[model samples]
Target: MSLCIENLRAWYGAAQVLHGVNLVIGEGEAVALAGRNGSGRSTLAKAIMGLVRCEGDMRYRDVRLVGLRPYRIARLGIGYVPETRDVFPALTVRENLLLGERKGTRFTTHEAYRLFPALEARAAVKAGLLSGGEQQMLALARTLAGDPSFVVIDEPGEGLAPHVLAQVAACLKTLRERGVAMLLIEERLTIARMLDARVAVMGHGAIRFDGPIEAFARDAQVMREWLFVG
Candidate 1:
């Protein structure tokens, strides 16, 4: 396994948000963490990135990731893109990408541009002026510039137009071809199905179902109760 979480737990101040979340991502695999909003999916991603206080055995390859600083985690080839899309507004597109190249030893800006062609066209433009989808692309591009072996992406499809989402899916496909593993948190079943990745359904701070995406489509009761709780 490239990433493993054993009984992961996290809290916001005094409130516990995650309860014994267990997960694994094998080498070069894209895995989806699927659930409704506020279902602890994002929390799981944050906990793995060490953005919040957490308790559990988080292992990347052979190294234990728990207690490590967020920067340290990033240096260990773990790239994280939070739901907020933390791109610097004042910087030019190229500058924002430069900031993400902190490691000074991994993927190049040109590589990121190749994955997101729109970014290449907007390299000279101010990052703040880009559309939401473009900002999301820049965010992913910035993370990719750091050359993480595995990526943790949170709510990537949120607020994106259907056309833009298709572009994002194509970028993900390219990432897979490059052998970059991913732990994706998304609501769109279509994207999940297209990726044909492993899926884990989360609710109330715990995983309710973990299996193939096709299994999720077949289990109507599971969808109605856990995945599609509308």
Candidate 2:
């Protein structure tokens, strides 16, 4: 499925963050959204998932998504894993993943375990006690369990150790190979490079730059101006 956003605007109460943002992630494509804090990257992600008040077009596979409830949007095969890595404190890892399951068959629990062995190993443990990286894995695995055609993942590698990060990357690679579209919001340039993804730089609630990573790299001005790199 394809995800297309055009002239998107979002607000938190009275504060507007995204200012006419436009982006598109075609089926089987992966795109990275990078920016400094308060640049509206997270807000845009939330808007796409119907988690925030939004105006403008948010479409997936030709169907309009604006004004839909968050769950309704998920029902359309779009999954969101927020940056917060919120897991059920009282639920076991298995239970948490089961909660992500849908009525139709998708990524089965067995497949999820194969993709994320650490989660399988700790299936009986309470999700709240897992390490931060583990929690992030659980969150990603749970979202993928729904077999979403497209996913909006926020900061999946925020604080992972090197090994855990590799595991996470591998899991995501499987999804990419399966042609699952992804919108990844991340601060780490390395993640973008690893995915070999097109890059979009957001600044002051708008997309300041959108192009191949190579172009963004070649143009030092974009990094300096939008991202504060010297």
Worst 10 residues of 2 by lDDT: 101-110
Model 2 stretches astray by more than 4 angstroms: none
lDDT scores in order:
0.87, 0.89
**Cα-based lDDT at residue 206, candidate 1:** 87
TM values, all candidates: 0.94, 0.97
As for model 1, its CA RMSD to the true structure in angstroms is: 1.6
TM-score of 1: 0.94
TM-score of 2: 0.97
Per-residue lDDT of model 2, residues 69-126, tens digit only? 9989998899999999889979999999999987674687888888788989999999
